[model samples]
Target: MSAREPSYFAKCACGKFCAELYGEPFLMGGANCYCNDCVAACYYCDDKARKEGKTNISMRCADYQGAGAAISCWLLDNLRITSGKDQLRGFKMSAKSPLCRTYTACCCTPMIYIGQKFAPRWRAFNLNCVTRASDGQPLKPTEMSNVMGDFALKEAWDQIPAGQPKYKMIPWGLFPKVLAVIFLPFLFPGSTVKVLEEDRAVPGMFIDAAMVTEVVSAETYVAAGVRVPKALLEDKKGK
Candidate 1:
């Protein structure tokens, strides 16, 4: 089957610049990020550039699809540059990183990073330079790793719903097993098959309605530094 397509539009702060997206809206699942590089880039370079008399710190680009020739043509022809080409600057990181090819010249803003990498047959319009209102909300990461571990927080993942049309969804019931099978190897040091098997047997017992009372009691007991079962608690409280 052909891969899914996602697209988005971005604009600069001035409202004078805008770009269109034509490919998969997200490059990776849940904002896959390389923490060391991204953190250094954002804090030392991007943040510094902004502090140095940079009013329009935002950069914007649109994701698109189609052949490379067509995509390049579209970007050059259609991308409306509303302001400060002189301020633009492109920075290159690893020669292997996809940004190497895309971040050719930082003519408009030095801090703004733009580059292309082989991604699910899609493109990412770096959002750092977006200055227009139409640039849409900040680019929510599709996958995030390391950093503040904010991405690991359950609340962060809650923003997206299950079974959204644009993306595939894993059933909540299957999540633990799926995660164990897929990620446990990388997360844990040893063989994951056994761990995954064990995990699958438990299979999110905390969320099971049948175990809610027990789970709640365990939580309360733990909070109180006591060991009491829900049944015992109920009995003692005459509930």
Candidate 2:
């Protein structure tokens, strides 16, 4: 069954993929993925927690929901970075593909997944963090129906969506900007990414991993979730 419970904390609602409903600036489409990649990316890839030795962690990745669907949006513009600005971290399935997914390193909150596996700069945010824009309404992700991955094949991926990449349906119009992300310097100005290279030699293959280095804002970490200490908040306020 698809997880249809909406998040009360999600302030932004990514636009649906219906062409008729959304005209120009198609924005981004949402999906419920249950592929192995999405599952592992949500669980493991916790270098921060591993290094910090923080066990008993609870994360909110897309798959945790029954449907396993996440919202697809452009992190560059769509994401407003309300809070937890400094706690954001990222990881990929492997070094070859740069489909990086993000989570809050502080609280282990799996928030978004971004990649260029099929399309350019695919920003798949955790739909659990997605809420209706008006009236702060909540959305039942499972009730919304699964788009990318299916519930029948939970662990197996044979029944996945058959589109361009044989896994997802990419909006061709968004290709221009998606492909252009590769041209931009690894450490572009204003990018919150920290590039980390893989040790294994891939010869001419892309083995670079873009990890988050620091979080600028220290006032608060997460909204409606983790919070910073009053002393820390006061210190930031003093500064």
Candidate 3:
């Protein structure tokens, strides 16, 4: 991607946070991910809104009453938090979880998720956080339904329209795609991948991983006066 390539803007509902996503959704593609963890992340953010007395604030993501689906895309070396970076914070479903999803503290909008596999090389942006594509084009369409079907979120699972392809989990092909992207900067030195300088500080980037909070169980939300989503409660029962 060139420096002048069309970029996408992802802003939190309160207009307090924004991220510029350079380049397009690469090899990993986009999807409506209905995994339990994703749903919980939405509910957690919604609860944050309610607790902050910003009940009217939109979290910009959801699936149904109790379960949620995140319209997300995986990109390599393409994200830059342009504003309200100081207000961005990360949380994990559990201490052992390898993923950390970020929320805009000002409005509780979950903006991005970073997985442990490749660190800062790649990040997943919640498309719900993106309200505009600067290329004067429509945002990328979701290419698949992931972690859906006969598993997870009984109530919301039935709500998904039939006929489209659904996967119980991400396909194995994704691993290789991610690996390829991780190595792309080496193969093509002219690629648009940005590398952070040692002394530079970029909030919302994975560098703050040490400060991420761990939400161990439903009680963790209760203690904070936030209701745990029913989908998460069901997951606990099944486990």
* TM-score of candidate 3 against the unseen true structure: 0.72
Q: If ranked by lDDT, best first, what sequence of candidates would result?
A: 3, 2, 1
Q: Which ten residues in a row have the lowest lDDT in candidate 1?
A: 65-74
What TM-score would you give candidate 1 relative to the actual structure? 0.33
Q: Which candidate has the highest lDDT of all?
A: 3
For model 3, name the residue pairs that clash.
none
**Model 3: which ten-residue window has the lowest total lDDT?**
55-64
lDDT of 3 by residue, 1-239 (tens): 64644377777778788777776665444566665566666667777777887632333234355344555564545666667878777787765455667777787777776553344466666666665464544365556544544345666666666885566666666767766677766777787456467313333454444555545477654542334557557768887
Provide the overall lDDT of each model, using Cα atoms, as 2-decimal numbers.
Answer: 0.31, 0.39, 0.60
- Per-candidate clashes, comma-separated: 38, 12, 0
TM-score of structure candidate 2: 0.44
Q: How does each model score on TM-score?
A: 0.33, 0.44, 0.72
Q: How many steric overlaps does candidate 1 have?
A: 38
Best by TM-score: 3
Q: Estimate the lDDT of model 2.
A: 0.39
The sequence of per-residue lDDT tens digits that candidate 1 reaches over residues 42-91 is 32332344555444432211111100110111122223333333323333
Q: For model 2, how does the per-residue alpha-carbon lDDT over 25-130 read when each residue is reduced to its tens digit? A: 1134444454445544444433345556653122323332222334544433323344443454555444333454556655454565654343232345555545
Instruction: Rank all candidate structures by their TM-score, best first, as comma-separated numbers.
Output: 3, 2, 1
